[model samples]
Target: MNKSIVFLMVILWLAQGLYAQTYRKDLPDIAISKDVSLHFISPEPIQYVDISTHAIAGDLPLKNVLRLKIVPDSVTHFALTGSVAGIVTVVGESFIAQYNLRYTEGQAFTVPSQVNILPEHTRPLDVPGIALTSKEMQDFAMRILQQPAESTLRKAKAFGIQAKLNHVYTAGDHIFLDITYYNKSNLSYQIDEQRFKIEDKKITKATNVQSVEITPVWQLYPNTAFKKQYRNIYVLKKATFPGNKVLNIELTEKQISGRVLTLKLKYDDLLKADAF
Candidate 1:
């Protein structure tokens, strides 16, 4: 099947929260400089945006494919890389468009007041943080769903942790808990600085659980549907579930006052690994 056809099917699945996007096929093709510094400006606020060029045929250099960065300098103007180039398409929750451009060694280019965030019935929500948008989120969510469901250790939703748990395992005396934190409400939390803690609900200053460590499995930003759910793996030390089958976990936002999430985990809901 044609790549465009395949992408269209995926696009349809995402049309619900996305705007109809198209490229300015008629726009004059731009030639990029050797340094690959391309720039453009958007008139309206881009709630989320991503830009990429499709390979026409054979393999392209890894740098060309990976160096493409859409860095928003401010609310409207942003920078693009010209070092590697091809036909670039820009898409967002409320906007969709493309720019036909070529990256030629030693040639630099700047967009001349081009590109528009085509009007849409549903306006994009101006959420704080990265402008990666929802397209990337949907792409990631699909990837997560493609994983084997049996690999999921425990799935639960509460305290800003959305939908499902990613994975869980135990090695020696430590317990590893894979979790994804998401923001579905108008309220937003700084994911990068988020923290976690595990304690016994029944006992005050209990000595049962030793230590808990958190490792970010993925970097999270705002606006993208799946991106909102930042993935993390908690390395718990000497953690043991009591006979009563209850676990208490807390999520905290240092910047916000009274912004803490308490998760009540039941033993029966937890899928134990073979080691346990």
Candidate 2:
């Protein structure tokens, strides 16, 4: 081949190879990306407790409505959304709903990138189909029941992030936290006891407990559900004091920050008989 012709042919071949490369999509590649993520995470480790005391209300779904109830211990769905829509969303099915009691098969997968995702329980965890934490949902249920926002003291009807205290609230003092919920129901639920655990990093003896009442409030959207039940295992530090001399409520920085940690032991009882 002529030297100039051969050089031209080489250039053409290189151009073809470049064009054949896989891009974000088919058209002219505006920005190319090799940024993919892989998630190697344990199924969000939940401290699952069986319902001990069922807080049922008229708004709770009829027991007959549950096709499946056991939440599978699987890594819930996750995704990474980008801006400037040339869109192709890459996400998986909701692990909680997908791996229900009905589906006896396991369908968990790892992402391509080695990223560790810790699924923290917030009022809103991005797991599709799963709303607020079970407790928050129960708070919603309680609101539907028309429970007073304040059971004498503390705010229950307002909204705040769920956090725990760093120290075990000594048996004789007030432990405080801030919180609220949405239109939801927590069937067969229980928050039997609330105390600051020994390992929490938030609450301590030095913390303050503000004496503000948090009444459980509900902003229910029309046409949804039948009944709901929710109550924190720990609300008032001195829910039932040894003596009725004078109950004083105090607020700590931790409580004010809404990061007060409390150990809540929960239990569940299967209520498939009388639908509440």
Candidate 3:
């Protein structure tokens, strides 16, 4: 035997072994039935789901937030004959999962009542984005809370309630605003609406005022009622506006009392935000 031929054969054998290990045939099977449905729960929100065959169907009942529901397709005539198997792939925000789906006549004791996607069975997804997750945002907010309030922006007081902007911080592509509300009176403040908008600083009677609403991407410490004082951190995407416009933070109380507190943040105030 030639030395080169032996070396070539050894390389081919190693390559084949590596390929076999990568695509193992011993995937765990999930039993599916027309009458019985299978539910899968993921650690994070699901991004995509792919069913390899027409014998089974899958859908995100909660709009792909976290749960995936699977059922056997009745219209697939081939499923009625005998056993039908397919592959199911579920992609989540941080992980990917694959499973072998098998159609069965009826639900059996071996059938899993619910499938919880385990971290060990999933591979990490390399999603490209600078956006922070909710948990990360919340953790950042906690760090901001530890800093002393240094902002002296506009404040509002109404119906024995005082609201003010405490601090502003900038990081990457997002801005964090720390706000505090104090109830001077003993009555509890029940917040009905919390809104942010950019509007003209000065409005004339003859001129129609234009306002654009800004929605916060994340909020820390979400609560509706507070007695003495309430503090929260709101996260918003970084944006730019003209000097003539001001960011308005409005908090309206629930019905009956219907009191409103409004705070204004000028464009200059946003520019003064300290980097975290």
Candidate 4:
């Protein structure tokens, strides 16, 4: 009954508030340098692209896959910027999906971290569940279908923010990124293991990249028994000077390893007209 009240309040809060989101980049609790430092923020995984791996992924370097290779048409940051579900109008430590409206830069650009709040505007009470991992999908689905009076709720540990830059690069371009996160451990949390294309920075583009699925990594099958269950949000970050002529590019998660993955530009370059 207590849980129902809390969940109900959350539902009413979201359903009643209908404020439109503003454009901005989401930064971390601490400040960072944009040049050589990459902060691994915890961003909600795009579940539609979630993949799973069969066999255990052996020792692999994360840098090989998470590097940025192309410039994006729009840079968005999913972070904390809204109101607490059951709290007052003032948004102090609320989570938000920050979409930064920008294009690629010939030179590196730095976005400052500011604790900006979305102005208190009339918001619909029916916003979707806060972005989370696939396993958390059940909760999201529940929030959408079940009424607050009947909802079963599980609280989350912390909210996270991540930046996605859409870009296309050409051949012969090189990238080097140095990424940093809250703490190496806090930032390494990941899910969906099929997206990693493991290799060195020296090799620019290779078509034959191995991929996997989400079911295998989560071990969600009823037949299989497991001791621990994990819920993670991985932040795939690009340091400085990603690779060349890369297009239609985005970060993905591998099935078995829970690492960040990216597609190479050897095959195609995304034009401004074709970008999402």
The candidate that achieves the highest lDDT relative to the unseen native structure: 3
Q: What is the C-alpha RMSD of each candidate to the true structure, in Å?
A: 19.2, 20.0, 11.1, 26.2
For each candidate, what is the lDDT? Answer: 0.43, 0.26, 0.75, 0.26
Best by TM-score: 3
lDDT by residue for model 1 (1-276), tens: 999999987866564223222335564465544344354343333333344432222221221121233222211111233223445544333454455555443423453223333343123444444333334434444444455544544455554545345655444444445566666656655433444434444654545754343443222233122336556444444344554545555556545443555555555534454332
Give the residue spans of candidate 3 off by over 4 A: 1-39, 52-85, 101-130, 146-154, 221-223
Which lDDT tens digits does candidate 2 get at residues 1-276?
Answer: 799999987876664443232224322212211232212232332322221111101111221121112122211110111211121111222222111011112223321223222233122236543333343433534443453434222222212323222111211132222222221323321233222221222345886533323232212222122224222323332233222122221111223234222223211111111121
Candidate 2 regions off by >4 Å? 1-35, 38-137, 140-239, 252-276
Q: Which clashing pairs does model 3 show? A: none
Top-down lDDT ranking: 3, 1, 2, 4
**Positional deviation of 213 in candidate 3, in angstroms?**
1.3
Question: In candidate 3, how many clashes are counted?
Answer: 0
Clashing pairs in 1: 32-107, 33-107, 33-108, 34-106, 36-82, 36-83
On residues 1-276, what C-alpha lDDT tens digit does candidate 3 reach at each position? 999999988976664443221222666667666565678877666778876654456668763333323433443443333444556788876678888766666655656657888877788777666366555687889998897766656578888998878888887789999898989998888989899999999989997999999999888877599999898999999989999999989999898888888888998888988886
TM-score of every candidate: 0.32, 0.18, 0.67, 0.17
List residue ranges in candidate 4 displaced over 4 A: 1-34, 47-96, 99-217, 220-276
